[model samples]
Every structure is written in C-alpha cells, then in structure tokens.
Target: MKKYFNRFPHAVRGITYATGNDFGFRTQVYLGLVVAFIVFAIYSPLSLFEFLFILLGWFLILITELQNSALEIALDQLHPELHDSIGRSKDMAAGAVLLAGLFLTIVLIALLLSRLI
Candidate 1:
C-alpha cells in the first residue's frame, strides 16, 4: 500500500509531462472537457448516470492515450530503430483509443438525437 502511494507521484508527473508536452494529448483534454460539459448540461436532467458513463469513457480513452504515449517514449529511448514489434505495440494501444472514441461518438450522437426528439 505504501509502495503504491509512493508511486502515485511518478504517475501524476508522467501525466503532467504528457499533458504539457504532447499536442495531441492537450487537444484530447480540451475536447474531453467540452464533451463532458455538453453532456452534463444537456443530458443531466434526463439521466445523470448516463452522462457519467460518457464522462467515464472519455477519461478511459485519455488514460489509455497517456499510457500509450509513455510506452512509445520509453521504447524509443531504449532503441530508436524501426522495430516491427514495438511499432505494433504502439499501434495497438492507439487502436484501443480509436475504438473507444468511435463508440463514444456514436453514443453521444444517439443521446443527443434522443434528447432533441
């Protein structure tokens, strides 16, 4: 438990570094906030839990992206060569984020349409 608590700082520092240095990460953060606000403002009255689910999905994608970025940076530092396995690993991580985003987008569109109708 103590070890895990101690490691929290490092994880937070990594997230901070990524948020500051990665343009894509920053864009996603901004977009997530916007989507979150829109969801809460428009959907909360109907279903707070559903709005929370959407926010959770957004956080999940952002977390996965940060982890992916960390892994790619570590792999690059270890060896900058065009390694096939490393590339595949990075791509798979990115694919997770893409899939999550696609699902979330569909959910948002459906929810918004339902709300309007």
Candidate 2:
C-alpha cells in the first residue's frame, strides 16, 4: 500500500507540468469543466448512468490528450532538431487526439439522441 501511495505525487507532478506547459491540454480541461457545468445545469436531475457516461467521455478525451502530449514532449526533447520522421510521429499523436475528440463527439450525440427519444 505504501508503495502504491508513493506514485500519487509523481502523477500529480506530471499532470501539473502538462497543465502548465501544454496549451491544448489546459484548454481541453477548462472546456470540459465548462461543458460539464452546462450539461448539469441544463439537465439538473441527471441519472447515474448519464452522469457516468459523460464522465467517461470527458476522461477519454483527457487520457488521449495526455498520451499525445507526452509523446510529443518526449520526442521533441530527444530530438530537438527538425526531421521528417519526427514530424510524422507528432502528426500521428495529434491524429490520436483527433480520433478521441471524434469519439467524445459521438458520445455526446448519443446522449442527446437518447434524451430526445
């Protein structure tokens, strides 16, 4: 248990570093919070299932952004000089983010449709 507990600070530090250094990550977090607020405000009595689905969608976006940002940061640090391959690698990471965003969009659309029905 102690060994497991030690990881939290490291995780927090990484999250803090990303929050400070990555604009896209920061924007997504803030936007997610705002969107969540709007959703709950609009639908005040949200069901547990709906709430969990929204949370999962938002977390999926964050997880992808973190993974993308970590990869880009590591690649940039290891190879500061510009190269075509590095550029492609970064693009692929960004593509992952795009795919995640699309997934969240689909989740939102599904939620909306379910509510409408």
Candidate 3:
C-alpha cells in the first residue's frame, strides 16, 4: 500500500509541470473550455454515448499532446544540437498530435451536426 501511494506526488508534479510549462497542454485546455461552453449552450442533455464519445476524443487529444510535449523535451535535452534525425523525430511527434486533433475535430463536427440537424 505504501509503495502504491508513493507515486501519487510524482504524478501530481508531472501534471503540474506539464500544465504550467507546455504550451500545447495549455492550448488543449483552452480548447476544452471552448468546447464545454459550446456543449452547454448548444447541445445540452447530450446522450450518454455521445457524451462518452466526445470525452474519448478529448482524452485522445490531451494524451497525445502530452506525449508530444514529453518527446520534444526529452529530445531537446538529449541532443541540443540540430540533427536531421532529431528533427524528423520531433516532426513525427508533432504529426501525431495533429492527427489526433484532426480526429477530435471530425468527431466534434459529427456530434454538432447530429444535434443541430
């Protein structure tokens, strides 16, 4: 039990650090706020499945952004000098976040259309 509890502070610290320092994390949070407002104003009383789907999409975007941030930070620390492979690695991480955001956008659009139409 003590062993399991020991990890909580580290987890909290990581979240605090990311929220404070990662621009992508902050952007996602702002976007999430906008989404929440839209949902409240335009699509109240969402169906359970619809709500769950939207939550999943948001989770994917947040998690991917966190991963991309971590990767970039790690790569930068490991190799401050500009290298072709390092650049490619960073680009791939960014691409992953972009894809996740695109997917979330598609899901949000579908949900909005379902509600509006």
Best model per TM-score:
3
lDDT (Cα atoms) of all candidates against the true structure: 0.83, 0.87, 0.86
Q: Distance from true position, residue 4, model 1, in Å?
A: 2.5
Better of 1 and 3 by lDDT: 3
Q: List the residue pairs that clash in candidate 3.
A: none
Off by over 4 Å in 2: none
Instruction: Give a tens-digit lDDT track for model 3, residues 1-117.
Output: 999899999978877898999988989978987986888678888889878887888888888888889999999999999999999999998898888888878888998888679
Score residue 107 of candidate 1 by CA lDDT.
76
Measured by lDDT, the strongest candidate is 2
Say which prediction, candidate 2 or candidate 3, comes out ahead on lDDT: 2
When sorted by lDDT, best at the front, the candidate numbers are 2, 3, 1
Cα lDDT of model 1 by residue, 18-106, tens digit: 89998768888999999888777867775776776687778877887887788888989998999899899889988988987887898
Clash statistics: count for each candidate: 0, 0, 0
* Number of residue pairs clashing in candidate 1, backbone atoms closer than 3 angstroms, sequence gap of 3 or more or interchain: 0
